[model samples]
Target: MNHTKRSGTPVKRSLKVALVYLLVGGLWILFSDAAVERVVSDPEMLTRLQTWKGWAFVAFTGGVLYLVMLRQFQNDRVMLDRQLGQQEEIRRLSQFQQSVIDNANIWINVLDPDGRVLIWNRAAEEISGYSSDAVTGSDTVWEKLYPDPDYRAWVLERVSRIMAGDEEAEGLETTIATGHNGNRTIAWNSRSFLDAAGRTAGSIAIGMDVTEPRAAESTLKARERQLRTIMDNLPGMAYRCLYDEYWTMKFISSGCRDLTGYEPDELIDNRHLPWVDLMFADESDAVSSAVDDAIAAAEPFSVEYRLRRANGDIIWVWERGRAVEDDGGMVLEGIILDVTERKQLESRLSEMATLDPLTGQFNRRETDRILQEEVTRAERYGRKLAILWVDLDHFKDVNDSRGHAVGDEVLRSISLRLADSIRTVDTLGRFGGEEFIVVLPEMSVDEAWDVAERLRVRVADEPIRVSDGDPLTLTISIGVAVYPDHAESAEGLCNMADKAMYQAKDQGRNRTMVFSQVAGTIESDKSGEA
Candidate 1:
């Protein structure tokens, strides 16, 4: 278009003139000598013009004719050369493009709006396992390439819209079967191609095998879903907090509401009361230290403390958190969990382990622990301490005759009576079976004896009632021991009191004996006092 006009007509005038000049030059050369001689001999011709002038005219005319023919030939040669150069360049470019397409790793295909293959490249040949001879000028591509005809139709519709100039075709990726055997899965990105007139020519598609990447992505998505499910359904609050004075909540799961009476959104980003605000002021330093240690060491930590609830109720809570660090060893992550229920359970279990379940009183271990602590206190404060051990009289007769259920009831009754009998400051625990022990702080032997007699009378006077039938009367024998005077340690005090109790039981039972002497003598023996 740029080189010249596009008419097919030849240069008629130029061609005729060139041929005529050639013929005239040949005829002149053939007859020029004879013709010159005849003109010289003519008398009339001599009168009008000389022979030499005629010869000069012939030479000039012949030369002009030859130059015109030569000029025309040179012009044709120039145009021919230009055309040949252009054709050669076009052929080289076509070869280069073919080589590129053949060697490319990207699979490429050209399709018409009807999902028919139009121009399939060499890359497509290698990938789809189909050659141009097999696929071109045919619609077999749709049958094999598009496993789902409906999906193919949907894509064709969209592509048609693009072809119609309704929209610019952009990346449209979808999974499809590809490869030489037609079993490989690949991801395809398709777009429409426009022709010289801005009209739809066909569609161009580029594809890559992404089966492995897609599988890995699917696995990651599944794991994310599982973690989300666990976090959403956990029984307690789990959260991440910033290591600051506020211990601000950074990420809190949905379960936060159940524990703190605040929604997850309310607590996140320090919107609601933060950890520092919710904790007891006295325990804040301890909480901070625990967190610091954990963060410094990238280890787990736990703290037992009190939490102030939204309703202003002080409730005990156990907080546990672990630190997560970056590759550079910086603590960039934190996980916090609510352990309130667990702490409450631990306290309850400790109580159960150390104290008798039925009596709600300290058991032997608890008694010994308190005795040791009080002995140290007594040594420091110079205060006197005493122990009084008591044994029930004929308590087993009630159990054996009436059933163990009644016996259990009797034990509970005795425990309650013993609790009521002791002073608020004094300590009492069911030692084992029907044996009871009492601890007195800053009390003399006479004071302890008075308290013991009071407890003894209370037990003897209380009528034991069984659910089966009738109420019965019971009695207790008492043995007294003064701490640090009659015995120096818990074991000695327990042994001396136990010996005294057996002596009271021996003196016909229901009697009080003081183990003040080595061969302890019975001081009081009243069977009918109650």
Candidate 2:
């Protein structure tokens, strides 16, 4: 609209000037000629006056022409000055725009409709390692950047589609071969522009290098895979979880299935059940307390407790964990190992150390230790204590006749009978070959004799059965000794009881004898077998 107004103003001003000139010239001619004809009468005087009028007319017309020319020249000069100023401003604006494009950090390039390079900015030159003088006004830069014919074709096809308005130009990425630097990956955004006639002219593209970022991403992924592999191969379950009552799991390793009989997904975030739910009800509180204490102290924690597996079997587990700071809050990271086998082995080892393997009764060493402890307690409390030393009658005859295997069966049977005959407070142990000792606390001499008789009767009342032979009748000779009555110490009592047992065996087999300390001489009360 402004262009139309500007063009129309020049035409209107020209028309006004032409009409003024015509009107002035027509008025001057009509008025001057009519006045000359009316004022002049004589022929000679009229000719002279006409000549003077002609000269004045000539001068008047010349003056009018001169004024018109001077006004036109002034108008032309003003227009020319305004036009020159506008042209200078346009040149400065173009220079500024070019400076911005050339100095921009991002790669900017323009291509003609025929795919020839039209404008290549300084950034493009720096990124591509190709100068503007080398790339501009030619399409050969495309080949230099993309050496592979097929790849270049694909890139050109995409660009063509963008120019045709069939595909969006934003975020179109491509790899290019730089002139000096190695191949680099780039991300591109492009658009097509139109000329004054609204026809497709050329396209401009902006690119960003993404080579370093892509390399870093790839390295991170590889490291993640390595970490995952290590976790999966571990012998126990490894986990990271929030330090809460539920122990909300953030990550659980693949070993979860083998350790807990549950998949990792099943336990993560308490999807199926919380980790605390797997702990034994009685031990969970102690375990929680230990962890809390360790966390408060900013130290690592280790606890051994029982866990109820998915199949309802209880197993011992050892766990080691530490509190770690995370973005959200404090969390726990740890590993759990099944220690059930180790616990069972330890129990068996303890039994092996204290009990006789054949009969499962206290061995000599453990029996002696218990006797000493009972003696010490009785001495401290001034309570009476008694001990019975019993031996099988003619046990060597059984071993010689029935072989050692049958002898072992007989020994085992007799040991069970002796164990069942004694009170729970009494301790029954194998003192030696075919010999047993029973320690009784808070028992007097009479009570010790009674217990010794009962033990003898219990063994003699039944014929011990063997696995591969007929049952054989057996009997035991018993000896009784009381603390502070016959002996003051455990060793003294054992010696006294042993002497009484040999005396019973000497008198006759299968009888009981009680040792006495009257006048520092040994005495006995003999009881025949039942």
Candidate 3:
């Protein structure tokens, strides 16, 4: 619009100037010629006036031309200033875009159709350790970045496929060598486009180094494999479980077989078997409560309990574990080792401490303890307990003549018979040479007397066959004492029973006597006063 309007201005100015000149010149010519003719008598004088009119016309035309050219120059100057302002705006906008790309952390590359660099941003220069002048037009720069020819060919082939093929490389990962760093892993995003003339413009790729992250991923994979191997080789199952009533197993190691006679498949995620079912029925509540308490306190624990295996066999085990509760998502993780052998050994050691090696009965220490306990129980319940002090008749002669081995054989036989004659709750133990004590829990003196008589008959009627000699008949004299009836204390009662046994010996060889028969105080000597 402005160009069209300006183009018409020169014609308008010419028309106005032409009109003015025509008007003024017509008047001047008409009047001036008349005046010249009137005032001059000679024709030469009239010609001079006409000449002056001609000079005036020339001067007036020159002045009009100067004003018109000045106006045109002013209009041209305004147009030029507007054009300059627009060009400055466009230049600033282009600089702003370039600055943004240069400061971006990622490397940017722009190439021509021949793969020669057309643009390499600041990041590219900083990372590649080369200035833009060095890389922008160098065809050999691509080779320096990726040294191997075959690798370059492969990359070019791939880039070609991406540019021309139906499927393009949206986000491609590749490796490149840095001038100083040797090698760098990169993730690239590239695209091929058309130029202004609609020809292929090669590709532009934006890349980021991923060397550290890739190395971390590789290390993680290796660590995971190593942990899995350790889990597989464990002697017992390593488990992660939910803090549920069943202590549901979420994950279990392959060593589940060695500990529970079950496969990992049977326990993991509680598929077919729950961990709670493995505990002994009587111990389940105690064990669960204990673990819950530990978790509540955020403490670690070690407890011993019985667990039942798949084959219905029960074994003892020691379990140590910790509870990790974060954000209230409770998870239980720990190892369960097969400590059955250790438990068995402990049980054997306990038995050895309390049982006699020779007669397989309660030894002296255990018998005394049991006697004291039974007495306390009897007193508490207002009931009676019977303790029998028994002696063998003529066992010394057998030991002296035959051998101590024969005496041992006789004693073992007597112990067997006594054991058979007593109640299940009774305890029998050898007190000393030819002396055995039997403790009957919850038995009255009358009941104890019957038990004593049964034992006496069983022993006397039974004969022991010596290894080298003929069979020897044995008779036992028993003295019975009732708890809190004969004497209130174990020591006093035992003394009374001892006196009763000696009385039986004094009366005859084989007999049964009750402590009430000699209710008086009995001395340490068989039957003397204190």
Candidate 4:
């Protein structure tokens, strides 16, 4: 803002003005001499007026110079005023920045490379329980603030490194023993001010109190550790695994030993073997496929299957897992528990519901369900299905003449004979008392009739050997009905087969009859009515 006024500049410019005046006056004297000589005859009169004329010429030139110079002075003054105003604004802005630094929520401290505090803000004083005077004047602030000598030295090195050009700036996290207020963790970004030659003048650090957040993070880690302890003691094995075919175990809880007869260390990172290898080989494919499907849908899955333990004992396991994608990779976390007992119980119950208790064949209820499904499938695909209604020709006679126990043996024998006669895909069920129903999928009426005849012959050829009685010959009559040909629905097909079996009985038992005879009669009636 300061511009020195040169001592001789004004005088020099004034001398230049005087020289211009003298040059002009000399010109006037030289040019006007002849005119004055011709105009004035009296010499005394001319001399008296000449002095006044010279004074007037000097005054006129001086007035013209003053006016032009005054205009120049006004412009210079305006420029000086503008410069002064700009300087004032700059000073105000500098003051505003200082105010912001002093009043900011974050603690600010400017320190010399020697660790002497140069500037301490109000926030620093409030947080550290130190006054501005105490902080700024004391070069040994770290003596009370950083109790550990090593820590104090480390803090001092932060600024010293910047000063020594080893670092430009640093982000610092440290703990400060704040007098009686205990300790506070601070996160700071420190930058050093450098002189023109790039030597560090001092360091300014802007920092925030991170004590609460650090404490919260500590609490969270403790809680997680607690939860992990609970999971380790649980009955089931909690596992986090890599998304691979082996379901490679990452973290296996302590329950692994009790659950799988293996220690946690033996399973983690697959130290002993892959966890997937624990499963039955076929079951492994099924479980991995299910897990992959769940991963594609971003969902969880549950399955029950057998696993071979380290003790070489096979046990059923119920596993539930969830797939999560992170960092463009996948992680599967799950729990596996021993469900061998539960699975055995369920299987027993299911078998009791589905299979015949006396004959060990499918019961009537399951038979109906299978027949309905086969009928629907045949209808949907325009495929054929056949129902064979088989009746033991003289089952009641055996039960009446012999004991019920012998009848049971005979029924069991006949069941085995019928079971051996049918293909694997066909279903056989006891149709209440002496009648057994057979469901043949993808079999036409002729094929069903052939099967029925074959089964009848099989039963009759083998004389059932009973402990109490002689070998008795058995005969079975069968009726065949085709789906969507004789009847459309499963119930309709069963009814048609039943009626055909009665027809076989009336035509003399031990024979197979197709339902088309009845259907032909119905069609003939309809034709006659038409």
Q: What is the C-alpha lDDT of each candidate?
A: 0.73, 0.88, 0.81, 0.83
Give the per-residue lDDT digits (tens) of candidate 1, residues 303-398.
Answer: 777776676766676566676754544332433456667777888999998889978899889988988887778778877888878888888887
Q: Name the top TM-score candidate.
A: 2
lDDT of 2 by residue, 1-530 (tens): 99999889979988998898788778877887778778987778878877887788789878977998898999999999999999999998778658887888888888888888888888788889999999788988889999999999999898897776567677777899999899988989898888999987988888888889878988999999998998989888899999888878899999888888988899998999999899877888898899999999999999999888889888888999999999969999999989999999998998899899888899999999999999999999999999999999989999999999999998899999999988999999998799999999999988888888878877888888788779999989988899988888999999999988887887786888888676644455556534
What is residue 477's positional error in candidate 1, in angstroms? 7.6
For model 3, the stretches where C-alpha displacement exceeds 4 angstroms are 1-100, 148-157, 163-167, 170-172, 194-200, 396-410, 432-434, 464-473, 516-530
Could you tell me the lDDT of residue 95 within candidate 3?
90
* Worst-scoring 10-residue span by lDDT in model 3: 521-530
- Residue pairs clashing in model 4 are none
lDDT of 2 at 99: 82
In candidate 2, the residue pairs with backbone N, CA or C atoms under 3 Å apart (3 or more residues apart, or in different chains) clash, namely none
CA displacement after TM-score superposition, residue 366 of candidate 1 (Å) = 3.4
**Candidate 1 to truth, TM:** 0.67
Leading candidate by lDDT: 2
Residue 124 C-alpha lDDT in model 4: 90
lDDT of 4 by residue, 8-75 (tens): 77689889978987898888887666666678878997786677677877788779978978987998
lDDT against true structure, model 2? 0.88
If the candidates were sorted by their TM-score against the true structure, best first, what order would they fall in? 2, 3, 1, 4
Compared with the true structure, model 3 gives a TM-score of 0.73
Candidate 1 vs candidate 4, lDDT winner: 4
TM-score winner, 2 or 3: 2
Question: What lDDT score goes with residue 24 in model 3?
Answer: 82
**Candidate 3: C-alpha RMSD after superposition:** 9.3
